[model samples]
Target: MKVSSMDESGKYDKANERLAQVKEEVGKVMVGQEDVIEQVLISILCDGNILLESNPGMGKTKMISTISKVLGLEFSRIQNTPDLMPSDITGTHIVDESADTTDFVFQKGPIFANMILADEINRATPKTQSALLEAMQEKQVTVGNNSYSLDDPFFLMATQNPIEQEGTYPLPEAQRDRFMMKVELDYPSLEEENKIVDRFTSELDFEPELENVISRSSLIRLQEFTRKVPIANDLREKAVNIASATREKEELDYGASPRASMNIVLASKARALIEGRNHVSEKDIKEVAKPVLRHRIGLSFQAEKQGMNEDKIIDQIIEQQ
Candidate 1:
């Protein structure tokens, strides 16, 4: 889909302006992982949740922290542990002695921040894992008997360690579907690594000031624009076909849910806006297919025993479709 440079509505120009500012801010601290950054932006712009899988020391936390700083938002980090409780994440109520009565006042946890970094999410127990579902889906946190809406432009960037499978309670299917994308961060190039080491070991821990270019109102406008991005009938049908193939294919056990199709289309639209286009394209759909659908689809026992990863299965589905 080739969009004209001059959009009649002029909305494309606004999206591009904000995108440029975000990219410029992200560039200050992050060395590589451009695709990862783009995917994260897609989720944020679409008001969707993200689940990031990466080996330790890949700077997943740093990337999210940079995003928060650039946006001039409050950032919070939570380290998920096996013994962590739901209250630890969602916060519990406390009694006020001055009031002389017990009122369920929500204290709010790390999840209440504008930008939250959930480090080692899978390490937390399933009970604790369920605590995030409401916040991620409804943009609100419920503690005790009261609910509190999170800040505007709320984003959850959760990281999970893939190397450690033991003693980890994998996120259930229902909870996993709430995430918009599951991005995998890989090792940086030798040159990038060299730069990182030199910059970090030196006394000059370079921290760049990310200018606040987009305001709360502008972000809401961009999200509305994302919804208005055109998705042709044929492209929408193609997205469904690709999702269905994952379930019907001989190599796979289960297929992606209806939510997968919804996320793909929405994410594709966001990607188009990020690229300065007003309409979604097949290329955008294909680019985000794996991350959006990988966790949503279940694998067969044989496929799992054979060590077939979700990425490989997603590739086959996209190719066949």
Candidate 2:
């Protein structure tokens, strides 16, 4: 973790090289969303869930699926809908009949995978959404008095459309807090959009063959190394101060919890490792602040009336710190 020795330095360098390869592999299918890809990688390294916000047809699913393949992790997707039941995602027990006897058997659901893409997550009713709560936080599923452990390196990336609100159930505050970071994917730039169109239209079936850049065990080790990334005492304090400032700000009705503070520091460490750095910096904290605090904090009526948003409030807090 220290990387002071030549062997540790070599491992650190190899990790970054493989991570860059992962981005390159994902970039083949995904047009241009470097920031989005990096955020997802950071969440994975931290072993935390992500809440992704974007409009439809933005390749959110493709991005996640492609990354799963490149990282060599098991991928499963759940298309959330109002009628989707808890059993649909978490599986249910069924009666198994044999020649002489019948017994109940436990079946596994899509949540057993290493990476789960919960598409259009807001479309699911609160009851169905709550079903994911235990799995997301505990990495285990409970079915009929039995608990089953999820695979290693498990994380859920849930997506919601920002343009649509009707007939959609907003994620409750508790569920939203379960996500380590809430990432907003904007529309691609003109150049990127053109590339996207040309890339898909040119071929009858467009599928970019991507290599497995990192294996499951290596990924697990990298996640452990992410935590070992060092940070200066002052930078660590700065991260805490930024989270604490949210509660003190008058423009917000309620601020982020202590969990937010922990996420900021952990995420910063992950970011530093991703950037091929040995230590965390102020820039790392500032870069991750908005995504870490946006969904956790609420704006006051006055702030909302003034057209102020969570990002703006977060920026002010960072400036103060």
Q: Identify the candidate with maximal lDDT.
A: 2
Local accuracy of candidate 1 as per-residue lDDT tens digits, 112-207: 888889899999988899999999889998876678899888888899988456766789988889998999988999999998887677756677
lDDT of 2: 0.92
Model 1 CA lDDT for position 195: 84
lDDT of 2 by residue, 1-321 (tens): 454687777777887888899999999899899999999999999999999898888989989999999999999999998899999999999888864688889889999999999999999999999999999999999988999999998999998988356778888999988999999999999999999999999999999889999999999999999988888999989998999899999999999998999999999998888898878988999999999999999999999999999999999989887
Candidate 1 structure, TM-score to reference: 0.93
Per-model TM against the reference: 0.93, 0.97
Model 2: residues with Cα > 4 Å off, grouped in runs: 1-4
- The CA lDDT of each predicted structure is 0.85, 0.92
- Best TM-score goes to which candidate? 2
- Output the worst ten-in-a-row residue range by lDDT, candidate 2: 1-10
